[model samples]
Structure formats: C-alpha cells, structure tokens
Target: MQLEEPQLKPRDYVVVASMLFGLFFGAGNLIFPLHLGQIAGANWLPATLGFLVTAVVLPLLSVLAISATHAEGVYDIGRPLGKWFALTFMVLIHATIGPLFGTPRTATVAFTTGIAPMLPKQWSSAGLLVFSALFFLAAFLLSYKERKITSAIGKVLNPTFLLLLAVVFFVGFLHPFGAPSSAPVTAHYQQAGLLNGFLQGYNTMDALAGLAFGVTVVTAVRGLGLKRDRTVSAVTAKAGVLATAAIGLVYVLLILLGAMSTNYFTASAEGGTAFNQIITYYFGAAGHALLATMLTVTCLTTAVGLVAAFAQDFHKHFPKVSYTAWLAMMSFASFLTANFGLETIIQWSTPMLMFLYPLAMVLIGLSTTSAWFHRAPVVYGFVVAFTVVPALMDMVAAFPAVISKSAVGLAVTHLRDYLPFATVGLGWLVPALIGLALGLTVYAVQQRQHAGAQEME
Candidate 1:
C-alpha cells in the first residue's frame, strides 16, 4: 500500500522546458546561426530547416533517449557498449564538450563578440591573452568553491543576458538590415545549403550537450514529482519538445538578424564579429561596452560551469588527481587555446565535431530503440565498430587545409570519397546504416539461437 506521486500539470512542464532551454542555449547557440545566415544568405530558409533537424530534432531525441534508457550522465549513456568502449566514448565526449574545445570556445566567443570590437587590431592577440587568462582564472577560483556562482548565472545573469539579447533582437529586427531573400548567397552555400546548414548545426554542440545534460534534466523532472519511469519519460519528451521549440525559434531570429546585417556590413570572420557590428550599428559607440559586458558575463558564467563540470567529472573517475588540480589544468588549457583567435578555434573544432557527431548519433539512436533489440551488446558493438572507419576518415578529411592536403590527409580523403554523402561532410551515413543493418541481423540471430537453446534445456 503506497501513495502515488502527484501528476504534474502543463504549467510545471513549462518550467522544466525553460530549464532545459537554459542548459541548451549558450555562446554557440547565439553566434552559429548568425554566421549560417550570413553565409547561406538567400538560401537561409533550407539552411535554417536543416539546422533545426540536427540542432533541435537530435537534441530533443537525446533527452528522450536518456529517460528511455534510465541512464545517469553520459557515462551511463555509453555503458551498454561495454566498459572500455563506454569509457572511451565518455572521454571523447567530455573532451570535445569540455576543456579541449567547448570551454575555450566560451572565452573566444566572449572575446570576439565583446572585447575585440573595442580593441585595436594590433592589440587583438594581447587582448585575448589577458582576457581569457583572467576569465578562466576567475572561473577556476569560483569552480573551486563548489559552483555557487551557477546560481548567479542562472537566477540573475541568464535572465539579464536574455533580456539584453531580447532588446537587441527587438531593435535590430525592427529596423531590418536587409531581406534574406535579396541577400547574396555565397558559392558553397549555393551548392549545398542544406548539408552546410546541417554541418553548421554542429557548432551549437547541443547534441553532445543533450547527452551530458540528460541526467540533469531527468533529476529536475524527478524533483518536479514525477516518480514513475513511464511517466517520467513522457514528461521528459514533452518538456524536450517545448524546450527545443523555443531554441529553434531563437535560432531563426538570430539568423534573420545576421541576414539583415548584410545591408550595412560585409561578412566578418565569424558570427561573433557580426554580432558586435550589429550592436554597434544600433546603439553606436556606447553599445560597445554594453554588448561586450553582456557577452563576457554570460560567456564567463558558461565557462565556469563547463570547467566545474569537467573537473568534477574527471575527479570522480580518477581520484588520484585532486579536483583543484583538474580544474587548474582545464582552465589553463582553455585559456591557452583561446589565444589562437576565434576563427582558428572554430575551424579546428569542425573536424572533431564531424567525427564525433555520427558516433554519438548512432548511440542515441540505439538507446532510443533499446527495447526492440533487448539491449544486446553485440548490436551495439557491431554498429560502432562498423561506423568507426568511415567516421575516422571523415574526421581526417576535414583537417586544416595544411594537414588536409598533406599526404596522410589526401590518402584518407581518397578513401572517404568512396563513401556516399562524403561530399557534404556526412560520409559516415551510409556506413552507419549498414552497421545498423548488420547489428540487427546479429541481434536477431542471437535471439533465435537462445530460444532454441532454451527449448533443448
């Protein structure tokens, strides 16, 4: 005789949806779509739609996969693949989404959007060094203190940033820079706008965040009083839809804002520059500090959270290293990486994202369909194994031009060219499908074999 937990109402899911969106929206969410619009230009419609598929659709599915699998954190998300493979997957995910790329990206974005506009060209390098140094240092200090500042980032700074951004969106859209239809479409965009947009969604990094933020969202839902597993999964899926819907809308608006800017300004290095230019246009010289402060504070808060999460997760795994030590290393690495400038950082990040996304996508797909296959390890193993070769080739094919044209890269490129969809940076697709077919075949065979053995017993 147990009392049932009270069911949540629609209003309660709105709060959960907002929480999920807060986790999804960050520096990348702000800039990537703007850059996509600027480059895609007249083709922004298909591009935006494609971006929504990866950015919104995949992430929403990922959140649901988390509940479907009853997993905690990204580590558990990969556990079905086997201990060693799971550990490897977890390491790759956290590294990409943490110290190696995502954390440094936070500082670089803040610098490019906020600080660079206010500084002279010669001072740009020096400015980034100083800013990222102090930025990560402060982050390290705060993370050392049990992440209390997240409260500030959440309760205070996040809302403030959103409010300020909303004002920018309101005014910028109101005036209108130019029509997206009339904007000039770049050559690459003209050729492959949809695929380019899909790739561009990788910049949001939300797919990976979807995996990382899974447990957090689930815990939040549980805290909201949904205790049954089925109920929790339903609530999570509904909440995910609401959250991703909001994100998709924001992405569209950001793209529009960027497309409009083409009327007054030429393309910049990345979306950050465009963002700074747009703010300056609307608010004049005074907008400089306003935009800079806003981006830095928002990005800083994001940086602190990433570093804390990274340090905390790594510390739990390898207790030989102290939390403070892990925190210091990640902060320092991210600061050093930021000095390379935003353009280079983004360029470098693309290759890794190209490789990891397909693998993560496969995992999420498997997790969602776990019940059909009875969570078979052979199925998980075969799919990942088959997908690895093509994924690696796609990654190598996307290396920096210097490396990409080098002998090793060229060899990999030749191999990748043989794979379908290779041209659009998704050469892994056919291979992944083939892998799925093989895994299912093996899973079905195993099920029949076990059934026969049971009859004999």
Candidate 2:
C-alpha cells in the first residue's frame, strides 16, 4: 500500500554527516577545548578525556536517541512527558540556543576573536555593531529556506571551514609552539581534572544543540529519500558517528595546540582570546586573517542552523506566524543581543543553562533507554519531577546572592552537603538516577496490575 523511498548512497551519508559537524562546531566548539587545554596543562590527557565525554559523547548520544524515537523535532522527543511539558521544554531549548544566548554568542565571538583584534581599541564597539548586523543578515538569508540548509552548510560552508581549520592544525602541529609548558594547574584542574573538564564541556552547550539540531538531520535524511523509521535511525546513527569523529579530531588538535602555546601566550580571560593569541604566535599577521576567516565561517554556519531550527519549531506550533517572520524576528533579536558581547551573554546564560542542562540530559537518557520502559508517560513524569528538584537547586546555587541571605538559601545550602557531586555542580546526578529507578519500579507494578485486571475480565 505504501512506496518505500530510495535509500541514500554512502556519499550522501558523508555529506549529511559533514553538515551535522558544521552545525555543532561553532564558536563555543572552537574556544572551549583550547581553553581546557591551556588550563588543564599537565593534566590535559585526563581532562581531554572528560571533555570528550560531555562534549562529544553526550551530544552524539542525544542524536542517536532522537533518531531512535523517530522524533519530528525536539518537542516530539519530549512528548512522552506531556504536551505542555514538551512545549515548554522545546521552547526553552530553542530560545536558549537561538536569540537569547547561542545565536548572539556566535556573532559576538566571531567579532571578538576574528575582527576586533585587527581594529583599534576605540573602534571595537562600533565595529561589533556593524559586523553583527551584517553577520545576522547573512545568517538570516542562508536560513530562509530550511530545506537547503544541508546543501548550503554541507556542500559549501563546511568545506571552506574545514580547509581553514586544516591550515591552523597543520601549522600548529608542524611547528611546535615552544613545547607544552609544565604550568601549574588551575584550581579546578589541580585535583579533579577530569571532573573539571567534564564541567567545562558543558560550556559548549552542544548537547542542547544536538537536541535542537536533530530535526535538521532528520529532515536531511528524509530528503535523501529514506522514509522508514528504522532505516532513518540507522542512517542518523552512522551520520552522528561520523560527525562526532570529525568534531573529536578537531577538539583534540585544538586542545593540544592550546597546551603547547600556554608558555608563549599570556593567560586570557576568554578562550577566544587565547585561541587568537595562539594563531598569531604561530603565523604572525597572516594567522590573524586565517583565524578571522575560520571563525566567521564556522559561526555563520552555526547561526544558520540555530535560526533555521528555531523558526521551523516555532512555525510548526504557531502556523499563523510565517517562518520568514520568525526568522526575521530571531535574527533581529540575536543582532541586538550580540552588541552585549560574549562575556555578558555568558554571564546571563549561566543560571539558565544550570537549570536546563540537567533536565535535557535526563530527557536524553530516558529517550535513549525508552525501549526498556515501553514509553510510559508516568516514568517520564516522575523522572522529570525528581530531576527538577536538583535542577532548581543548581539554578539557585548559580546565583547564590539571589537567595543567599534568605531562609530558603540557608536550607538549600545545608541540603547540598547531603547531595553527591553537589560541590562539583552536578548535584542532579544522584537524584536523576533515583528518579529513574523509582519510576521503573512504579511502571513495572502498574503493568503487572493491568495484566492481572485484564485476565480477570
């Protein structure tokens, strides 16, 4: 009764995978690993491993989980929870990775690292405004047609971006930046290097991006004429592996470059600054030009992906609002917010990310393991409810002054002592596990009871 769509060839798989890599490899991806290497110093090995776990492993798993569910979008992945909960979570993710923080950071990072260094100090602010305006305008135009994102990013932008990075990698690898210094480890990296690295990886926010971008990957796969859910899932899984490999290779090389260059370059407050310093140290003025081009292209690709995803998701929910209108609004908001600069945007985003990351991880875990639970709504509800407790605590901890002097703050502080990993910013781990176990128990009991009732009838 139904026609099966033609399967995509191996080359198509590589193209889609490259597109996914471009989407994930943005400003944060470029900066974070390099910073981790600089700070991790002698502990770079363990730190890099930990960074890979959260930055690469978790994000890849998220894509696989979404594909497993045959989700239409991030909202669909959350549907097992409830309609309202799915809507709320999806909206928060899109907003966080769209106009509020992610999109703006892309433009600001590009300007700060790529363009600002070339300009005079006094011209920085004005330069940013003009650059971000043009940046978002370009992203807006590229993202106008969601259907063509793969071709634009995969076929065009990704190759150029990779070529630029390859230049940096080749030069940095061939010419040693005065061997990696045996520098003193930073506070977090001194003892708990792995944990610190894991936490630092969270700064990339790629896992959240993975959830949001899964729809784009799915669409790309479908476009290649793969229609069956199982076939799509397999293709998505392979593509995720390829993308993960690409990003992982880049991260490792960047981390190594950062570590080696620590002695040559002074410590910078921002990762982008450190990265720019490394490039300049290796290749002089020409390196600056290369870094500028690499960052701009990578950031533009990321911005296009985020804007397209946000517009598509919102337009789906509110059919009356055209995708073009949503894209225009988001691009404008991102442009305005980019003027705030990277540091300020990061500061504002911390509390929100503190709350959202744990919940998103839990959802991803549940979705990945859903086959074991038969997609029970109660399991989703209970797990999320329990996960929220620690997530809220994390939010408060993120902004201690908001409740520091209050009774609630005192109570939360006291409760922290009882929570494992609370001191390391992962206070939610134990609670999430407990929630999963309890939800499973309850689900099992209910299923048994229903079976018994059916036999009695």
Candidate 3:
C-alpha cells in the first residue's frame, strides 16, 4: 500500500526548542539535580556534566533516533522483534512512565515541596492522598482537552515556572550561604556522585517517553498540513534540537545554583531540605511560599498530564476498559505510592532505572543504526545480549539489599566473581563487543553467499 507522506513547515527553532524543553524540564528535572549539586559541592561540576549527558544528551538522541528512522512510532523502531515485542516495549514505556514511576513521583514530590511542611505532622500522608486524588481529577478534566490545555500550558504556565526558577537559582547564586566544599556526605557517595547523578537524570525518562512523543509530534506537525516525508523528519530534528538545547541550559543553570547553594547551606540538608533552605535563605518566608505555590502547580500539572497521557495509552491497549476506569486505577496506584514519601520513592526507583536504562539505550542505538545495517536483526541480537549483562550488574549494585534477599541475588553474586569488570558495573561491555563481532562476521558470510548465488543466476 502506498502512503501519503507528511509535509513540513519553515522550522521555528525557538518555538520547537521551547516546546521540547518545556516537555522535558518537569518538576524533578529542576529541583532534584540542584540538590545533587549542593551535596556534591566541588564535585558538582563533573557530576552535573555527567548528569546532563544522560539526562540531556540521551533524550535528544532518542528524539533524533525516531526522526532519522521515520518509524511509525516507537513500536516500529523495535520491529525486528515482531508485533508482540513492540507491544511489550510499549507496555514497558507506559508502565515506566505511568503508575510505576512518573505519576507517583509527581504527586509525592509535589506534596513534599508544597503540602508537607504546612500540614500538622500527623495529617501529612492522609493529606497527600486526598490532595493527589483531587489533583489528578483536575488532570483528567484537563486531559479531556489535552491538546489545547497542554499547548496553553506550554505557552503561558511553563515560561512563568521557568522564570520563577531562574530567579530563585540566580538569586541563590549571587548570595550563596556556605562556600562550596569538597567534603561530601561520604567517600563512596562522593566518588560515585557523577554516575549516580547521571542515572538520576533517568527519572526524567524523556528518552523513553520520546519513543512515544516523537510520533505525537509528527502527527501534530502533519495536522498543520505538512505532508512530505523529508519535511516531517527535518521538522522533527529541528524540534528535537530546540528542545534539548533548552533542557541542557536549564540543567546547567540548576546545577550551578546547586553548587552555589553550598555557600549558604550545609551537608545536613540534602534533597528537599536543601531545596527549601536555599529558597528561604534567599527570598525569605514570602518568597518560599510563592515558590512553593509555583512548584505545587508545576508538579501537579505535570502529574495530570502524565497520568492522562498514560491512561489514554492504556485504554488503547486494553480496549475493553473505559478510560475512566483506567484513570481511576492509575490514580489510586499513584495515591498509594505517594504515601511512601519522596526519599523512599527515590531510593526504590534506582534499580529499575539501572535495569531499564541500558535496554532503552540499546533500543536507541539500534534504531539509529537501522539504515546502516538495513534494519538487520543480527545487530539487535548481539547488542541486546551484550548490554543486558552489564545492565543487570549495575542494577544489582545499585540495590544490594534487593539481591541479598532473593535466589536471583545469590546467582548474581556467584557470577560477579568470574565476570571481568563486574565489580565496576561494566560486565556487559566486553560481551556486547563480542556479540557485535559475531553478528558482523555472520552478516559478511551471508552477504558473500548471496553474491555468489546472484553471480551464478
């Protein structure tokens, strides 16, 4: 079947970039990284750079990968595995970004930043549950008309949030309370700060979300009446570059603010405490209250959008279910998770990212390489096999307690001794290379066979 192609427009780099940046720079994207910087102190710059590479660069590649390949969507990008593989990939994307991580995180962090301190100590969890439900219901209402609301939010609310954040960070930097110190909370944490910070950026998970957003963006552009293939790809690329640049700038600014916060704040404050303290130190109680309101609104809006998008996607997969039913299920899950508190949520989420990030990276790598290999399965097989091992090691290392309790943990410990570079979370690098070599060798032999057959014919 022949398909009508999508057309493009004279790219508006600023608008596209602004949209991309707005999409990526959710609440955690702004606050947590800064906290990481404050704690890392002198180590903040390196750690921040590493964080940006993963948080910023990987996400950009994800968008670029989709634009360059022109896959129908993320599923098409994983097509060598066939339909079910694509479905599973889709499910993972939804699960990762929905109730499992993203949705709950927005609620939890919002409460921490906006609601917790104001609540009587005992009423906090109950308050969070009630508040999150109301917040998500509002999200549902907004989601009913997502495009208009999202576009409006992008144009108005997003810029205001950014402005407020910029003011907070800039002011904090100008009058930092404590000097930047090399001393971190611990030696191991300090040594691993950059890597940890890099991985933490995964919580933004725009890379995974990009797999879906790319298709959405393409569709939006098409609706604008651009219907050519090259235009679609070009527009996608332009939009991606614009978005990533904004995200990178915000991350760098926040990290600097984090480092500078050390000049006023101390080690006892980390995570949310550092965040609140920095704002209060610079802006006084009124400033803190205003910023808190902005944060609550920002985080709540993000939560609603995430939940609505996920619920719509979920309903598509399970057509028997009503959107309302699914939204309720997701909202309930998010509500329960919010009670776990922000710090606990952050701790638990680490291993999942370690496990998922490498797989996501491989998908991005292969999708981008599809043209070079003519969409070969051989390359995919090798990369997946090689990368899975190291990613598993990294996941276990990040959560030793998880391994210590299960039979799987025992198996991993035994394997670690024989695995080269296993202690360093790089056990998979060698295996991946070997797999690539084997695949290339096989491809060469197959090509020769085809050449001989063609010559004979």
Clash pairs for candidate 2:
none
Model 2 deviation from the true structure expressed as Cα RMSD, one decimal place: 1.7
How far in Å is the alpha carbon of 7 misplaced in model 2?
Answer: 3.0
- Model 2 CA lDDT for position 97: 88
Q: What lDDT score belongs to each candidate, Candidate 1 first?
A: 0.80, 0.87, 0.69
Q: Write the per-residue lDDT of candidate 2 for residues 284-321, one digit (tens) a residue.
A: 99988988999999999999999988888888888899
Across 1-457, the per-residue lDDT of candidate 3 in tens digits comes to 6555544334444545555565566668767677777666777766777788778888888888878787645676677767787788777776766677777777777777766777798998788778777776666665554344435445665677777877876676676555455334435346887666765677777777777566556655554556777777777788788778777877877776677666655653445666776677777767667656767666755665566556555666677997767767877787777677777877777776767777787788778777777767777777777787777766776674756447877667667647776664556657767777887777778889999999999
Per-model TM-score, in order, reads 0.90, 0.96, 0.87
Model 2: per-residue Cα lDDT at residue 433: 84
The order by descending TM-score is 2, 1, 3
Write down the worst ten-residue block by lDDT for model 2: 396-405
Tens-place lDDT digits, model 1, residues 1-457: 6548886887777767765676677788888888888888888888898899899888887887887887756777788877777778878887887777888888888887888877899998888899989999887876676534434444555667778888988898788987878888888789778878988888888888788766556656676666777777788888888878988998999888787677678877678778878888899998999888777766766676577666666776778999889889989888888888777887888888988898888899988899898788888888888888888998888889898999999998998898888887878888888888998998888889999999999
> Residue 425 deviation, candidate 3, in Å?
3.5
